[model samples]
Target: MTSEEFGAAPTRGRRLRTVVVFHLADVTGPAKSLRPRLEAIARRGGGLDVLAPAEGSLAGAYGDLGTVCALPYASLTVPRTPREAARAVRSFARDVGLFRRELHRRRPNVVVVVTTALPAALIAARLEHLPTVVYVGETFPSRATDGTVRWLGGRVIARLCEALADRLVCCSETVARQFVRLGSTVTIYPGISRIYAEGDRAGFRARYGLEAASPVIAVVGNLTAGRGQDTAVRALALIRERLPGAQLVIAGLPHPRPIDEAFAASVHDLASELGVERSVVFTGFVERVADVYAAADVVVNPARFDEPFGRVALEALTAGRPVVASAVGAIPEVLRDGRDVLLVPRDDPVALAEAVSRLVEDPALRDRLVAEGSRRVESEFGEEAGIEAFEGVIADVLEQRSNGPRSRSSSPG
Candidate 1:
């Protein structure tokens, strides 16, 4: 059948098979972000396949996936050096060849490119004449951390990726704003898995060697300078004065950059310097994140940078824990100050401590925040809205493609 003949849209009951591609094996980035949606598509009796750097390397992170039909090839996440970037560009042709073979095999209804693997995936989509949707999770004008080299070709590469895609799905309004002038863009806030609500508090505390009655505060995300775990550790010094039994839990490993063991150690040194060494618990890379949230008296997202969207905060709120978050980027949009969460300026340990202390000391305030936070998560940050919105976008893009690709500028997003 001609592409125009297949322009008809699928009804509510029809199935839509999809193939999602990623660049890196990062445990919590685009690959992990889209896994739940892929499962949803499968439950509807629709087929799902994932193409990425390597399959078994990171598949274990998603322990819940009984079977993962992931495709692995030569790919890198955000190239740290110009040589690496140039090499990745050189490898694009090979990636396209591999992608073409996959297209012939699956004959997917649509191709979805998760964060990081942009131009390469886009090239593959166009080569196969398949509709493409790229989800933007990280910032653009992308730069490598700890390196001064400018990815001089980044802008040109980004423009090409934008022009080729049928649609761009951004993780937050802030991310959407960064790319609106490029081409079609839409804000689709990422969703957190509901499994967090099931973690047992007692088991989590026991695993971390935390006392059952201790007031534990959780600061999740990679242990990096930008993530601001130092701020949380420093706050522990101040928190211990008011609530002597208060403890701090740092629940993740280093980021994708050069493993910053020095920085991670520096955070611990700061904790010890503040005389709170005994109170700080570093639970490096726990698989059961829900457990960490459930065991916490309060949760904090103290990232110093403008976080694209703080999914950790959503997970905490979903688990019914009061949140103390940085009021920057799209976070203020996800959570409200005073009502749903206590929002403080980024990098301010004093304010972070005070906010966390308020939740720790005031039982009524904690209860109110927990109630409002869960309500907000259920209304917006839960899996249903995001999954439905993403699925609809993919379906619409495919329909437009099948319709013979008019400049459908009216609904550019």
Candidate 2:
């Protein structure tokens, strides 16, 4: 897609109306990143309507930008039992009918499915012959432990997406590479704002009982297994051996899944085992995440998995705090090793400790990383950049649909 295509004025006929279908109604990473894009649609005199599973924080936030509709949908999950598989088929068919009815009633010009998890929405849009855009944000895991059943399920989902959707907007090139067989794929980096850069440093430190002069290390994602909060805790113990006044602040809540909850408990247990529990603070969920960056001197992202995009690392750089992250996935795509962020090996506590300690002790290195990181975020990952890229994709899809029908082999049905 060219700049002229994306920057062109809206077609001078009927008004453009878009309906976005999402898998979850919670305040998740995808929902947060998509807010600016939705706003851009409204700014271009396009009507917006959102469909979600239920009512939650995301629904409320999107209500201001568009008409929020509560439509239930289920994700395609690998079921173990025979009964579970039967029920999954039933639920999927029911939800597809629901979505098809809703789309027919709304009569949108184009349909946007926020995540690849919602295959039903793509199928429904195809049945209606409406142009569709699906956002591919996650990479399917092909590890041995994932089990053959789950791996096959992932392949099925990818094939369904490739067949049904008109275009796939991937979050990063790493994610796009996974869908090489797909006909149309675009990599649009999610944007971040400078909201995190403005906060009360002294007030946040006082509220969290952190010493004014102590070195504070923060990890800002949800408490999940691959998030590597346990690694951060261990790194804190190693850092405190030299700078005894160091503190580690963990600032997000876990998902309701049993595995995630267990991982959260294990992180606390590991901190206690290292005898550094006293130096660690667990603030479950902060309403204003800017406060966490304000109280921290350095941020760490020791993710063990192939993170599709490092939003926390971007936010830290935008907040003007130096970052030490694992050199995995698309992280190295946006952040450099010495210039923008200090890249360390994944799941290695000793290496993570050394990087965090080096940044804390060397003020010149921290300043240089922060300066370079801020410049990169402004130039490439600003809010306007994402909006323009997404708008371009939408325009291209609409134009193609107007010209003729897209060629595809099969549908989910």
Candidate 3:
């Protein structure tokens, strides 16, 4: 469909209300990333109908955005055993009937689902003969010790996304490649906020008691084994030999999962064992990630496993700092090696340290990387892309439906 077709949607006398459903609790990473796009939908004489599970901190997560209501999905905040997972699935099936009733009552033009919630939402939207767009982030679950049940469940969810959804939008090209079964897919980077693009470097350093040239190296994200914080600490042990006063900053919060907290403690213990304990700082769960990026001379996203998108690397680049990251998953698709970012081998502390050292020693190299990174981030991942892409998909679906009724078995092209 042409871009011009997007703006042709009717929104004069009456507004087009949009409904979005996701199985989530609280305003975590995903909520924060897509909230801007939701606001944009609201700005175009449209409304946001948020349908999430009523359990946990969801009430606070969506706080006064659109018309918030509850769907009977499973709660992650509660103890999640295999039995609980099954119960949640059964509950979701039950909720589908209620949610379909809500859609009919609300009569939204389209439905948008944020990832795995697609199965139930798609089924409900189909009952109402409404088109759906599924926003896919991680195709598979990421955990250090992912039991077979969760992994198998993720596969089931992925298949449902393929079989039921009309259009599947991916968070990055990597995700698009891994999940292009039957639906037409598009890539839209959930760009970082303006605070990262314009944070105070000097002030952030001061707030953390960092000297003007202490050479801070930062790793930002949840404390997890797959994220590779331990590797960052080992790299710091290597970084300190060259720049003795160099520090490693770990900025993130641990999840309620025991493994997540245990992983955080393991990272700290590794630092001590390496005799770089004093140089490493663990800033637990700071909301201000841009500030963490600001305090760093070099930022690292050393993900051991492939990720859908390395958001921390994006934030670091937005903060105008040189970034060193592993060439895993969709990271290379977003940031180029030796251009916007420096890519290293996964789980190699020696390689990680060498890359960080190069940025520290070579001021000219850092400047080259920073300039390229800023330009790439601006042109490619601009503020409006997320909202615009979503709007275009919704518009396309509406326009197609206006042309004729879609066959129930017809796959999206």
Candidate 4:
């Protein structure tokens, strides 16, 4: 069929087969964030194939999610020095071969990629004339804990990805702003999948042996620096004094850097010193996150630096938990202060502690915040909204390709 013939808007029931590629191995927020939507798409009997850099459990986790198929390539770790660029290229070549094989088999209508590991997929999409969407999370090195050299490398790679991607799908407007800064066409606010249910809470809590009445707080995402897990740990210590029985859940992957081992040890020591170590549970990377949300009276995302977009904040809201996130990056866009969530300044452990304490002490305030947070997630970022946003970008990209190139105009994003 001609591109114009397919230009008619897709109806709600239409099945759209798509291929999503992101070379994330092991457990991390972006992988967790993308899985649900891919599962949903798969359940609709549409083709869904994921290309990732993971083996074992990560591969197995995606396998069980839905009809979507998972291909686990040996993950490419960030290179240390400019001299390692050749090694990085070789790694990318290997991943591209895997992706090409998968694409040849699936022949999906659209291509979606989260990270910069899939320039070949972008090229393939261009060659095949298939619509392509690139979901840019916090770019490497920028999001990495490394300093100047890695940052420079990250910028170079990011520039390459920007040049290749047909359309950029940013996790938040803040991330999209970066692409817009580079004169690229982009969409803001990525989608969230609703895998966990409200009814699953009791079972999940029971499994963890959490007390029925203990005030619970959860921190979801990878255990990395700048993510502010330590801030949450300290906040938990301070919270114990106000709400003596408060329990904190630190979930998701452990810290990515070995240097952070001392920091992790310090957090453990701090917890023990506060005498609330027993109350603080570090449940490393739970498969079913809905339960974590269920067992919590409040959710905290205290990322100490700019996160292109904080996915966990939306996840917490989707799970109907009151979120207290740092007022950094795109958080101010996702939540309202004293309404959907309690926003505190970044890097202030005291502020994080006080917010947790306030929420724990006031039940009414907690309830209101949770309700508002849920409403906001449903209204702006729920499954349907996310799907529409994604599909809209695809439609726009396809339309643009069909219309031919025009003078580039600055987009406000």
Highest TM-score model number: 2
Model 3 CA lDDT for position 308:
83
* Model 2 misplaced stretches (Cα beyond 4 Å): 1-14, 405-413
Q: Which pairs clash in the backbone of model 1?
A: none
Model 1 weakest lDDT span, ten residues long:
404-413
- The C-alpha lDDT values of all candidates are 0.76, 0.84, 0.76, 0.70
**What does candidate 2 score in Cα RMSD to the true structure?**
4.4
Task: Give the C-alpha miss distance for residue 117 in model 4, angstroms.
Answer: 4.2
Sort all candidates by lDDT, best to worst.
Answer: 2, 3, 1, 4
Ranking, TM-score, top scorer first: 2, 1, 3, 4
- TM-score for every candidate vs. truth? 0.84, 0.91, 0.83, 0.80
Residue 275, model 3: Cα distance from true site in angstroms: 2.9
Whichever of 2 and 3 has more lDDT, that candidate is 2
Candidate 1 residue-wise lDDT, 1-413, digit = tens: 24443355755445766777766655665555776766667667666666656554355644343334565565434576789778776676676667777765666667778764457667766766778888887765435532333343445545666788889888888877765354488888777777889888999888779999889999988898878999999888888888999999999887545656778989989988899989999999888888999899999999877787888888898899999999977788778898889999988989999999988889999999889888888887667787888777877786677557522112111
Q: Name model 4 segments beyond 4 Å from true.
A: 1-17, 25-46, 56-78, 101-106, 123-131, 139-146, 181-183, 191-206, 255-270, 273-275, 402-413
Task: Give lDDT tens digits, candidate 4, residues 1-413.
Answer: 33443344554444667777765556565666566656665676666666654443556767664334446554445577767868777766765666665665566656887776557667555545566777777745553456777677667656766777777767777766655346465645655666544527778678777888888888887666777887887787777777778888887665455856666667678788777788878887687788888778788999876877777877877777778899987888777898888999987878988988888778899889888877777777766666666656766665665555322222212
Clashing pairs in 4: none
Model 1 residue 396 distance off true place after TM-score fit, in angstroms: 0.9
- Per-residue lDDT of model 3, residues 147-243, tens digit only: 6666666666767777777788788888887664744787778867767866667887777777787999998887889889999999998888889
